[model samples]
Structures are given as structure tokens and as C-alpha cells.
Target chain A: MDLTFTERENAFRAECRAWLERHVPKESLGSGDTREGFARHLEWERELFDAGWAAVSWPKEYGGREASLFEWLIFEEEYYRAGAPNRVTQNGIFLLAPTLFEFGTEEQKARILRPMARGDVTWGQGWSEPNAGSDLASLRSTARRVEGGWLLSGQKTWCTRGAFCDMAYGLFRTDPAQKRHHGLTYFMFPLHGEGVTVRGVDRLDGDEGFAELFLDELFVPDRDVIGEVNQGWYVAMATTSSERGLTLRSPGRFMATASRLVDLYGRYRASAEPALRDAVIDAWIDAEAYRWYTFQTVTHMVDGQDVGASSSLNKVFWSEMDVRTHETALALIGDRLELDIDHDAPESAGDAVDEGAWMRGFEFALAGPIYAGTNEIQRNIIAERVLGLPRK
Target chain B: MRFAFTEDQLLLRDTVRGLLARECPPDVVRSAWEARSGRAPSVWAKLAEAGVTAMTLSEASGGLGMDELDLALVLEEAGYAGLPDPLVETVAVGAPLLEAVGTAAQKERWLDAAAAGDALIAVGFEGQPFVPHAAVAAVALLHRGGDLYAVPREELPLEPQVSVDRSRPIARVDYAPDARHRVDAGDRAALDAAVGVAFDRAAWATSCVLLGLTRRMLDLAVQYAKDREQFGKPIGAQQAIKHHLATALIRQELARPLVYRAAWSLAHRDSVRDHGAHVSMAKVHAANAARHVAKTALQVHGAIGYTIEHDLHLFQKRAWALAAMYGDVGFHRARVGAATLPD
Candidate 1:
């Protein structure tokens, strides 16, 4: 098996590395969860879209370069290596876009994909509700048959960046007679529609990163429904896999963090605990392992094998590794862990530590195991589905 | 880039796996513990006939001319069977080392026999205290003062050491390096470098075997969890047991790619530092996976797993023994750290 990148792939990497180096801001952008920060992130998204970098794996008709998955992975590596701002439109681009590509009608694709890629209409996930999480099929949201479309009514909580997003897509029970996983229809609706209200919720990091959506008979046209009605569970499972697997959390992200952690350890090597040193090394190795694992996965996908339940294993690993990488960085930061470093600080600040970025990163990493399906539920899926363990 | 074994490689792996299933079952492994030679010669001969022993040797030397990447899965199959032989020592390490540095006369004397599985060559690295299969081998290659010596087994003084897994017989070979025994008489420095790369190949091979042993332990645990019932249901129904096996499966799945990547690095002959780091990473991860899976398998099997009467102990002991060989987790981790972390 050949592991070295081809000449063309290396060229693609060089092109991406050059673009990211030139376009990425010198200073980190503000949290995309905040209103002003969302606007700023939107500008970066537009720049990426203009440069055909918004959706590298998507068809060119939709503002993308129609790059291969290997190229997409290369772009991600360059993206994170350049320390680019977090994608404020990730829920739409990463999670929903794959489903849309798979299940969206031609008309839906034409209307949604281009604007979505261009950041004209940002999208947030509306899957998890107050009652439905790990057991997502038990969602209480309903979509009643209407004259032209469906009338949706329910509460969708933890809609990441939903407070500012223009639209969302989720599963709704279309026929109450059928129990869990049945009778659900996937629908996309505008957040500011006639019967919808969005309220921001403060997250652990004190950012309005999550929103609660109250849908009161919101009218969604039949055109917005993805895939077949009553088969929404299947449609949404596609999105869940994307969220929990490769699209959302690429190995490049963790490798970048691991690199930073190594640098941080070097800065504190004189005073860092020996255990912390080992932790840094272990985290680095884990990241490297994840990178190769993803390559293996892409190889299989290229060979026509489906990821299926094995993505849960990927989720469990990267999510935990993300936490460990950040935790190690925080440990190296020592008592200064709680310092709220100013994002707007000058170039020379606090011995070039980036101050509280590690703390903020730690907070962000904390959400990984919780979101994209909790690690516990992923473990169950792995045991029963992947390993064929008996499920009582 | 393709990061997977080719069809031929996989076919070869399956052939070895099927052969081992028939010839080196648990009973054979059990018999090796009591055998005077601590080996199953029948299985070794079958592997030779199947071209496994000659895979890494050159075609000019009556061998397959395959590289580490081709034999990786085959090595894993060997580990899966817990075969009581010096396949890794002779095939993965010995033949290749001889092919690379052995004189033409040396190749004529031992390489052809090794490729035919008629002669077994055991290897002992400098830092390692014990030489595996030294008592049964026709010749033992020992490292001293950075020079490799090929001493005939008859001339070598072997002190047998009882391993936790008796199927794997290891020993201390006390042999003074002599001019006659020195294999790399032409270029000592180049020989030293070749020996260093051979050590990396050995480590990578051991990692592949560790992965196979880990998978075997996990499979036993999963099967046991399904069969062994408690509280009116199979114990596998319990979340604790399921989660334990699930975690082990995750480790196995993740560690495998690292091992495969190491095989690629060795096959491609990447920069010495890069390949060295890659091999160490593979060793560290595979060792961790084997260690964790062994514990989980034992815990899931309860007291039965502890007994020699049960088959689980065979793989568990093999995993434990191999996990510490070549380089343990901490040793490999430090190697990776040295390559990765800033000085």
C-alpha cells in the first residue's frame, strides 16, 4: 500500500497552504457564538466562498472546486495549520450539506447549496430537543399535514449558533400513530419564520453558542422536505453520521492542537511536571495515530466500503483525544489557566503563550464528547452494532 | 494514496490464517509448552511451503522478494494463532538481515535453508537480554560492540529462561564475538546502520503481532460475554461488560492503522528519524491495545480466564510477553517524544 501523497495531491496541498497563509487573519477571530463575531466569521466565509474554498468536496455548481475527498482532507490540514477562524457556517457546510447532497431534490440543491456555501443563509442543527438526545428517535416534535406543506410545532434545544442562523433542518414526527424512528420526516425551515422564536442560551464558556427554537405551526413547503417522508429517521441518520464522523472532526484539527501543545510544553519544559511532559507526548502520538486512521478510512471509502457503525469508534476516539490534548495544554499553563487572555492583545503578550487560548480551547473540547452524540451512546452503538454484542 | 493491503497480500494473509487454523490450534500451542524444543515444526514447515518464510527475502535468493507491507497481515495472522515458533525471528528479522548484510558464502550456507524453512535463525539485539528460539535455531545472530556475529547454535552457549508463555522459548546466549563469527566484515558502520533498520523492522513486526493478539483476546472476551450468563441474562447485556469490550475494540481499530502506516514507512524507507518515530508510535499503540484488551478479556471471563485450562490465557500470556518485547510502551513513547518534541 502506497502512503505517500501523489504529485497532484502535493500540489493541491501547496495551493491550499498558500491561500490559507495569505487569507487567514493574523489574529484569531472572536467566538462565532456572539452576534458581532458571527458577522465577522461570515465575512471570512464569504472570502473563502469567493476563492472556491468554502466547499472543496461539493460539486462546482455549488461554489466549490469539486475536489476529491483526499484533497478535502488536505485542505482541512492546511486550514487548521494556518490557524483560521472556526467556521461559523459549519453546521450547514459539514453536517447538513452531506445530507442535502445525498437527499436534496435538484430544486432544493440549486436553491440551498449555493447560498449556504456563500454564507447568504447560515444553517443550524435542530435535531436534539429537551426530551430527545442520545435516544434521538424519541423526539416529540411534530409535523402535521397542511394544505400545501407541513405545519411544524416543537421545541428544539441546543441548536448550535441557532440564535443567529437564518435556517435549520431537523426530524419531525409526521404520523403520531407510528412509534420511535418511524413516521419521522426531515424538514428545513427558516428560523425567523412566522411561527418560530429563537432564544439564545449561555453555554459553559458564557457564549450564546446554543439556541432554543420554539416552532409553533411553522409552515414548511413540501419542497424543503429531504428524502421521503416517514423515512426521516434514515435521512437524519445520514446527518448524524456526518456529524459524528469525518466531516465535522477531521484529524487535522487534533493534529494542529497537538502541535500547539508540544510548543506550549516546550515553553514550559523547565517548570512543567514530568507527568505533564508524558501527557503532552501521549496526546501528540494519539493525534498522529488518528491522522493515519483517517487515511485508512478514506482508503476504504475510496474502495467502496461504507463507514456505517464504525464511525462511532472514530467519534469516541477523536472526541476523547481532543479533550486530552487541550487538558494537557491547560496543565502546562499551570495556575495561569484561569487567565482571560484578551483576544485583541498586541503581538507581544504574556511570554507568547496566547494567554487563555488553552482555557477557551479546553472549554470547546469539553463539548465534543457531549455533542455529535455523547460518547456513551456512541459506545453502545459500537458494542451492539459494530461488535455484535447482545443488547438487552 | 492507498493505505490498504493489496488483494495478493490479503490472500497470502488468509492462506496463512487458514493454515494456522488447521495446524497450530490451541492444542498445538499447548503441546509446545510441554515439548522439548518449545516449537511446532509442522506449522513452520507449512508456512515455508506457503511462501511466508521466504516473503521478505529476494527473488534471487529463492524467495518472494516481498517487503514488510506484504508480510504485515501475515505476521498478524501468526500472532492470531499464537503460533509456537520463531517465525518473526527467522522470517521478519533473520532472513532479511542476512540478505542485507550476509556475505555471499553466508547467504549460500544459511539464506537458502532459511528461505526453505529448513534452518531457523534466531536474533538477539544488543539491549535485549534474551534471544528467542536460540535453543532450537541452527544459528544465533548476536550483537556486540555494534557488530553483528553469526554464531552457529552448536557453538553458542544458551541459558534457557522460562517465559510466562512457555510456547515462546527465550534464552540468554553467551557467545564471545570472534573474527570467524563476524558477519559484517567489510563495512562495520553500514552493517550497524542496517542492524538499526532491522531493529525497526522487528519492532514493526512485533507490533503487527501484538495487534493480532489483541484482536484474539477481544474476540474471546466478546464470545464469552455472549455465552456466560448472569442474573438471568448473558453478561454481555450488561453495559459495563459491553463498554469494556467496546473500548477494547476502539483501541484495536485505531492501533491497526498506525501499525499499517509503520509498515509503509519501513517499506518506503522514509527518513530514518521519521520511520523510527513511526515504528515507535506503532509499537506504543499496539502494546497499549494488547495490554488493555488482555485485561478486559480476563475481567470479562472472570476466574476461568485465569486458569491455564482455558484458552484465553494462552493469548493473554503471548500478548503480555510480546508487548514488552522490542520496546515497551514507555520506551517507544520516549522515542516518539524525542523525534517530535523540541529539544
Candidate 2:
């Protein structure tokens, strides 16, 4: 029940704080929506890798520090505190890599994980198809067996960073005889392969950050099969669990946003309405709640305990918290919500301070409820799996 | 660096949960509530036998000398059982307050009796209305002018006030910290510190009370949703019913950490002021979880949940009672505001 970190933990924190103090970029990373911005972010991830900070919790053999979960949590807190650039390789590094650690063969690991950790390649998720948005298992995407490999042919929409990513990993129907979750297989392939076409989608960010991939018999070699064939559903759960749960949305982002919200609120609070003040207070407490809850979770993982239904509950909380926190900031900002990230409205240029990012954050928060297995789906999981409610 | 409880504490939780499940079932709780005294003395005795009351009291005072975190787990279990007894008030607020600030004679009189479950002591913080267990308690611990006091229940005139939760016997007492009964100490500073301990301990326990009740309520709701068929299928199959219960699950999950963190903060004495906000957050979220789950449970159950025969209202009323006690959501939110917000 202790909250105080050990001297060793404190020393680790000090080392991390010192490294971030020096390495964080001096300027914004330009939203990483542009190709140049993405490359810069990739270079920043490389810097992190060189310093053994890219995936602090990953095993050292895979090019990580092999830090404890608590250390990883601490690193994340310091990373956000120091205003470090966003990780352009998060999807590959956090989601896919854990599955790799769990199920990938030695040969696949030797070939993929090191380069993935080094940021030499970036990856995007290709799980959702045009007809399989929420009910992903009902996907019509097919992969027929070929000589020494499989051929992938289908459409994958809402592919985050799909417009430019070099690689993707997703589920494919491996056997036509079995249905639903039975006959699927996990596969990873080059996004720029012979039969793949990526078209940029108009996303809320007004950038080509998201794209739709059209696959015309894309050949994926047998070596790229992640887990056992006809068991992609099982393998994909590991990645989705990581996605919706803890790996991606570290407390650092929430803590940073919360502090910014408080600092922003303080500027106009003296003249603001009291309800608005209470709303800000509520927002702050929710962030603090998330922060402390993560500590407990890291403790559970460290103690070798299963988080169980908490992943679903955490998904509902942080997504909603993101929305509420952003809304409160927008309410305080009043009318600056119209400014885009590259806003050049001269009259407000001196004070913008990237009010546009907050606007962008508000839009992104809306996506939180929609993506990562929509909150409704998450709630069903909680109700059914966690609460033991009856399934339809 | 460990954030989770020790194996012993985990065992203590499981034991209390098991004891309450067998000895303090819903029927026993109802019987105790419906009885003339509206409290289960046997349940209180069972808890005292289980060492819940004596855990935080000093061994010199014939107690276990455990800490707040230890007792918090037991209190959470009690809340889960919706136990209709004054044990939580007796131990968390009464004994701790007595040991911290009561005169030597006061400790000899109440603390030992409380540890043995031979007596009950109700606490009434300043500005609070209903004094719980005042009807059955032998004494009352109150605060006024920043000083703590203990007066025999026989000395104060009490006007009986019926509570929605029948097991909680409440009343408005007619007494203002009489000097003769004042538990005197060094000076105003020591008095304030002791009062803070009593206040924080009681408020934090009330938060646990809400948490336990919320879990019970959510469980009941989920069970009913699974069995109650609507339009030829279980209601839980419907997205609306599942969503309602899921939201309740979310509230319970979010609030559980706040409660534990508050327990940890107060147990470690990590910044009295920050801990104040910590407990306040727990209190606020507990009330939110309890009230929200109660409402959602009723909605999911339709007419059946609204009946007195049903178990939902019992937990609902108890949750609301605990929430209204110490401080409601708005009260603690303001306390949190004072603690965290700048002047």
C-alpha cells in the first residue's frame, strides 16, 4: 500500500528526467501529419532507441532497457513532463511487439523486432475492413493459401498511418471451412508490396494521417505468419488488449493535459463562473484518478496479477476523460476553437500558443470513443465478460 | 515501492468477505434491521471477534495495534455485506478518536469496551445531521469549536429520526460540547490535529461504505439483468441494459482506486492536506458510484427492484445513508476544491 518510490526508483526517475531534459526537441514536431514531420518524428524515435529509451519496458535482446513496468510508467511520466515528441512508431512498438514477444518465432523476431525497435520501419494497424468496422470478426477479407505463402485480397479502412507506413499487421481468414473466430490467421506484410494501394482519407485532423488500403492478391510469405494459423482471433486479442488497455495512453499525456488545463484555467479563473471552475476541478480529479489508477495497474502487472475486466473499464474511463478534459479547456478558451494547427490568423498569432492543438485534441478525443473497439463494444465486454452478464 | 496490499491483508479481505457471506447474509441483515433495535449485535460481535475493531487500536489498550489500511479492507467488506451494525463507527471513528484525544479515563471506559464489542459509540461530526447508531450506542463522540468531546448517550436528549435504511438508527441529538464532557488535551493545535484524525478516519471509512454498497448493488443489477427476460430474451442481451450495467461497472472500478489511494495516503500520512483531497476524492467518487449504480440497478430491474422485498433498495438506502453521512458528493467536492485550488 506504499506510494513512495524506492531510492533506486527515485534514482531511475532522476536519470530519466535528466535524459529527457536534454533530448526533448526545442520546437513542436509539426503534428507529424506531413511527410517531413513524420520523418522527423521517426528520427526522434531513433534517438530514443539509441539511448535505450524507445521501448523501455521491452527486453534488452529486442533493443530495449528491459526496465520494469513501474520504470516504464515512470519513464512515460517524465517523457510527457518534458514535452517529448509523440512516438510515431507506437502501433508497431507497443501493440504488435507484445504479440511478437508472446507468439513470434525466433526467426521472425530476429528479422523484425530489432529493426522495428530501431525505428528503421514504421507500422500501421490493418484490422478494420470497410464492412467490418465494429464487428471485426465478421470480416470478409480473405487470404488463400499459395505456394510457400498466402495471398491477401481485401480492403482495410481506417488504417492509422496506412498512407505512408512501410509495414502492417492484421488478421486474415486462413481457412474457408471454419467461420467467425475459428479459421483466421495473423499476418504481417510490407505495405508497399506489389498488390497494395493506399489512398489517403480525409480525417478529422485534415491530414493524410489515415488511409484506406486496397489489396489485390498481396503475397505474404509463410514466415510473416505471427501465431498458429486459424488462431488469429486469439493472437489479435493480445494486441487489442494492449491497444484498449494500458500500453498506449500512459498517464503522462493526461497529467500534462491536466496541468495545462489548470494553468489555462488559472489565467481567467478570477473572472470566470464558479460552475466552470468546478468543471475544471472535476477534470483535474479525473486525470489524477487515471494517474493513480495506472500506478495500481503497474503494481498488479509487477505482482503477476491479471487486470481482467479492468482493461474494458479503463478504456471507457480514459476516453471519456479525454473528451471531458478537452471540452473543459475549450470552454475556457471560448472562441479560439476555430484555429487550425497551422493557423495564420495574424490578429491572434501572438497569443495562439497552439490553441489549434487543443482544437485538434478535441477532435481526436471524439475518435477515442469511436476507435479501439467503440465504447459501446467495450461496455458490452465489461457487462458480459467482467460482470458475467448474459450474451445475446 | 509496493502499491498492492500484503498477502495477509489480502487474506484478511477474503476472510471478512467469507464471514459476511455466511454470517451476515441479506436475510440476517434484514432481520436485524426490522428488529426493535434495528442493529445486529451478533454481527457486531462477530466483526469484533474477527479483530476488525481492535486492528487499529494499540496493544496496550488490549488491541491489535494495526493501521488504517488494515481496517479499511475490513470496512470495505462490511460495506459489501451491507451489515446493519455500528461496528464501523465504533472502531474507525470512536476508538481512534478516543485513543488519539480521549482522556486516560475516557480510554479505559470506551476504548476497551469498544475493542471487545461490549459497547457501541456513535460519532456526530460538526454540521452533520443524523447521528448513526445513536439509538443503540452507549455514548456519543462529537466535535465543536475545533475540540473533540465524548458524552454518555444517557446525558444527551435524542429525537429519533427514521432513516431510509432501517438498519441505520439515526437521531438528532440535543447537546453542544459541554465542558464537563470535553476530552481535554494540550492546546488548540493538538485538539485540531486529533479532530483532523477523527474526521479523516470517519470520512474515509464512509467512502469505503459507499464502495462496498456500490459493488453489491452492481452485482445485484447484473444478476437480475441476466435472468430477467424482455421481449423473449434476457435484458442483459440488450445493449441498453448492458450499457447501464457497464457504466455502473466503470464507476465502481474508477472509484475503487481512489478509495485505495486515499487509504494509502492517510495510512502513510502523505501530506495531511493532500491526503485530505485524496479522501475527499474517494468520498466524492464513492457517492457517485453508489448513487449511480442504485439508479441504474432500479432501471434495469424495472418494478421488481423498487419493491421492499427486493434486496436492491436495502443497499440503495444504505448507500444513500452513508453518502449523506460525513459529507455528500457536493460537500466533499468543495472540500477538494479548497484543498487543490489556489486562493
Candidate 3:
């Protein structure tokens, strides 16, 4: 399909790119390094919010630009091209903001969405319990009905950014008497609230971006409930759909990153193995394909086609592609990859930006195919639902 | 802004679907497959009478004046029927190219004859002698020195090549330089646009045909799973069969929109940054999807599916053949890489 932007869209993109070049701090951008590097990355999000450039897809009422889906893509492209850090509040802004817009009450929107748009608050996901990673229906986290509110008690593992966030929105088993998927309810609980304990997961490089949380009778008001009680699975599914469905990255963004990787690879060419070059090319193709695929989806969405399954395919491709690109960078840096590169690292030292970002990328990419449903699951959806195969 | 087909396009799709249902049924395709000519001209006449031939040309040229994507819908249905007619060559390639580059005299004479079902046209390129459905055609478009010349079919030498696909007879056509009827336009640009449109349409039509075949493969797998017994239950109940079929469906689903998107973009002349990239992706994706589904269908059917007496191999052969058409997966993937890179 035709993938180029319109002149008007192009002009808008130029404006956004100009703004990004000025407002984004180069030091705070990710070299795909340590948890501290990610933390520094948040400063860029703060800058974007201050400049009114973040979360343009959110409704205007929540301090967003209320852009069309296509414009939103233009915004992301510019943001990525700027080489800004990944959003610390992506779960809140990309996933929860849309969820709140659709299913959240007006009051809830007023309370939670503005701070998120303003970069004043960060949110973490609390979906997977220790036993319920892929078979999400098997969650054991419990929340009992109380006189004033609900009392939550259970442990949530793999809680990304859980130890460092202001609040959490999770699916809790509000009715344990009901089995497998029926009894769960969605709740918005403050991570700093009483009776909640968070233990960060220590990585090989000592990054604690991921956490495990124990919710010991944490009280949450009925007002914090996202949608109808026990209907959270559907709501969660919808949220995941929006999370995966929208334009996640812009072509400009990938172009910038690919250029950076290419530069880094050139810098290390003497030490860099030939295999690394192949990986760079692979990353380049994936990034480009994903970019075109995204533009096509935006066109389809703008044209009013129901754009669900197609977006899933894009998510699967890009998420995996992101991992591959980052991993290639790590390989080029070799032993210097493990050093904790951060804002404090010397500007001239490549290791300052290496910090095993690629290894983490590999891990994250590995998880990507697993999270948002495995690639196998996506394939099944494509086959049965999209292709209309006879159900065996 | 609209991605869904316009009302008239929908009606055209329905009309073509109905016409194919009667004239190009499975039996007709089978009969043609069994015969020497590999095509039923009467069926082509019926399609021509239905105006499938003229739907892409301008009304002033005695045709419907539809865009390239509208004609794609007609071609897709024809592919589904395994219709051996040169509808793709005549309407999809020759007619559109003539409309773009033909002189007033040429369009007046040839366009009317083509629309009136009195002539058929085929494209002759230098490197590839094998033009799909080239035999039994009335007109040949020979490309040389970047210009397209209209050569009478009688003047060309065609060597019949045994093809894997029997539904369409292909021939390697050789042309002499002096026999060409040179046109006055910018031949290079015309040839470029024509080839692009032809590849886009062929890639998409082949994909939709694969879709139809894949859909049939999935059905066959599911039906066999339902009927066959294993471990005291229907094999359909087994996760192995169920999941295999499921994955095939996923690939098909993933590719369907892409095929339509490619066809739609070409039809409306949408953005070109993606120009060949999307179609390549669609073709590669569809080809792999169809191949996987067909292979899995045979595996699920176990013994009977492998027999030549069965229809499974027909889909398998078509998938293999279509995958090779319009450039194979490797070629199209490289095209995607080139299309997607920073300008």
C-alpha cells in the first residue's frame, strides 16, 4: 500500500521533529543500558510532557492533543527520531490512558489521567502472579469485599517497574468461589499505600526495573475499580488490544535508532565479528517492515476499517525486532556490554552507553513474544480467525 | 479515506463471483485441466459478455473506467475459479497500459476490439519467454528499447513449455525486432508503470487464489479432524491437529488485509513509499501461509491426501507455483528491504 505521509502530515512531522531536537536531552536517552539508564530516560518523558508533546493520542480532556490515529503515528515517529528514552509510564500512557478513556468513569479520568499526561505519575502493571504467567486465567491474587472498600492480599510477580511506581492497576480475584476467569476484578491500588510490600528482582547486572509485590490486605476504595466487577478479563483484554493495536513506534524513530546502531557498528568494526553485521542488516529490515506495516494500519484505521488482528502482527514483529537490534549493539560492544552505562558515563567511552543494554534487549524481546500472548498464539489467531480455517 | 470497497466495487465483486460460480466451476476447471488447450474460450466469452474485460478502461474507450484495484477484484475471482483465460494479461496488463500510453488511433481500434471480446492481448518481455496464458492469444505486446510495440500474435513464435499449473497454458514467445509496431509515447516510463501494475495485480491475484486454496485446505483439515478417530476421540479434539490448523489460519489472517491493502493502494494510487513493499510482504506472507496450510492439511489427512487421485495436491501444486510467480519469497523480501530504507 501507499505508505508516504501527506504534505500536511509531513509538515506536522517536521514541526514535531524540530521540537524533539530541542527539548530532548541526549544524555538521558537510552543506549539500551542499565535500569539506571532507563530511570534517566524518564527525564525525557518529563521534558516531552512539559513541552506538550507526550501522549498526543489521549483525549484533550486529559491534556492530550486529541490527534487522529495518523497524527498520533507522526508524533511517535518524531519522538523516536529524537532518540529520546523509552517512556517510564508507557503502561499508564499507552495502555491505561486509552483504557480510562474508553471504560473509565469521568471522575476516574479526571483523577488519574491528567497527572499521567503531565508526567507527574508513573504506573506499573500487576497482572501476572507467580503461577499465572501465560495461563493468565489461573491468577491467585485475591481481593475481599470490605465495608469501606476492598482488601487485596496476594503476590504479583514480574511486576515491571512495580518497585518504582506511584500506583498500580491490576486484576484481582474478587470472588474466589468462582473458578477460572469469572471471579477476577480490575483495581487501581497505590503502590505506596499501607500493607503493600515490593521486592525488586535483581538482574545479572543488578537492575531492578522488575519487581515482585506482596499485597497484604491493602485497602482500595470502590471508586478505584476500573469497570464492572468480575468483568476485568474482558477489560484487560481490551486494554492489551489497544496496547498492541496502536502505532507503537514511528519510522523516524527506528531510522534514528538504526543510524545510531550503524554508527556504533562502524566504530567497532575491527572488533565486531561478521555475524554482527548480518544481525545489523536483519534489524534494519525488521525496523523498516514494521514501519511500513504501521503506516498501512494507520491508513486502514483512518479509513474506518476494524483494525484489530493486523495490529497484533505489527506488535509481534516490532517487539521482536527491537530485541534483535539492541542485542546486535551488545554483541558489537563485546565485554564492555556489561558495564552500567548511565548519564554519568564519560561521553567519549562507548562502554558508557553499552551497559549490556542489548542483553536486556534480548531478554525483553524473549519476553515480548511471550507477553501480549505468545507468537504461537498470534499465529493461531491469524489462522483460525483471520483465515477462517475450520476448527480442528 | 475509505478502505472498504465502494458500493459499485462491491456490486462488481458480487457480479463476478456469481458469473464464476456458473461458468468457471470446479468441473469446468477440471475439464480444461484434462484437455490440451488448458482454457475454455466460451467461458471467456461469457466473462467478456459480462464486461469483465472492459471494466478497467475508460467509458470513452467503450469500457467501465474502473481503477486498477476494481479489476483486481475480478482477477481474484477468476484466479479462484482456476479460470485459464488471459483476463489478467488482456485486461489487467494490456488494457491499462494502452490506456496510459496508447495513441488516439491505437486506443480507438484496439481498445474497442478488446472491450468487444474480439481480441486478446499478451505482453512479451525479453528475459522471460514464459508469459502466463500466452498461447491462444490474439495480440502480443513486445517490449524493446524501453518501448512497447503491438505485434500481431500470428507473427510471433511461441514455444510451449510444460507447466506445473495445467489450468493456464504458458508459452515462451520469441519476437523479431522488425516485426514490432512501435508506439510514439515514452516507452520506458510506460513500460515501468505497466510492469509495476502488472506485478502488483499478479502478486495480489495469485495471493487471493492461494487464499481460496488455503481456505479449502483448512476446511479439509478441519473436516478430517472431525471425522477421523484417534485415542477414542475425534482427531479434531487433539491439540496437535487443532493447533496446527490454528496456526495456518493465523498466517492467512495476517496476510489477507495486506493483500487487500496492496490491491487497494494500487487501485487508488495511494502512497508509493511502500509501493512494492506491501505487495511483496503480502505475496511472501500469503505464499508461505498457503504452503504451510496445504502441507499441514496433507499431514492431518494422513494417507489419502497424498494420493494423486485426491484434490489436495492440486492446491499444493498451485501454492508452489503461485509462490514462484511475481518473484519468490526471497526476491520480494529484498524488495521490502529496499522500499523500507531511509531515502
Supply fnat for every model shown.
Answer: 0.84, 0.74, 0.12
Tell me what TM-score chain A of model 3 achieves: 0.87
lDDT per model, in order? 0.89, 0.84, 0.71
Candidate 1 lDDT score relative to the true structure: 0.89
TM-score of every candidate relative to the true structure: 0.98, 0.96, 0.85
**CA shift at A8, candidate 3, in angstroms?**
5.1
- By lDDT, is 1 or 2 better? 1
Per-residue lDDT tens digits for candidate 3, residues A1-392, read 33446787787788888887877776545432345555565666667776667777666666777677777777776776776667777888877877787789999999998788665787888888889876789999888999978999999987667767778888999888888889889899988868899888865434576788899999999999999999888788777777666533455666666767777766787886656765665566555555555665666677777876655565565566676787788788887776654434536355544444455455555666666666666655554454444445
Q: What is the C-alpha lDDT profile of model 1 across B1-343, one tens digit per residue? A: 8888899888888888899999999999999988746689899888888888888899988899998889899889988999878778898999989888877777888998999989998999988989989999988888887888888888898899999888878898777788788885468778987898889988999999999999888989999999999999999988998889999999998899999999988888855349999999999999999999999999999999989899999998899998999888888999999999999
What does candidate 1's lDDT look like per residue over A293-359, in tens digits? Answer: 9998999999999889989999999999988888888888888888764545424356433747788
Candidate 3 residues lying further than 4 Å off, grouped into runs, are: A1-8, A28-35, A203-206, A247-315, A320-348, A351-360, A379-392, B1-4, B99-110, B144-147, B180-229, B232-237, B242-250, B253-301, B330-343
Worst 10 residues of 3 chain B by lDDT: B334-343
Best by TM-score: 1
Instruction: State the displacement of the C-alpha of residue A302, model 1, in Å, after optimal TM-score superposition.
Output: 0.9
Give fnat (model 2). 0.74
- Best model per lDDT: 1
Error of 2 at A29 (Å): 1.2
Give me the chain B TM-score of candidate 2: 0.96
- What's the TM for model 3? 0.85
Residues A1-392, model 2: lDDT tens digits: 77888887899899999999998988777766556678878889889999999998887888888788888888988998898988889899989999999999999888888789888988999999988988999988889999999999889888888787899999989898998988999999888959999987868777678889899999999999998999999999999999988897988888888878787787768666878888888887888788788888888988888987678889889999999999988888777667666623323444555577788889888999988899999998988898888788
Can you give the DockQ of every candidate in the order shown? 0.86, 0.73, 0.21
Scored against the true structure, residue A237 in model 1 reaches a CA lDDT of 91
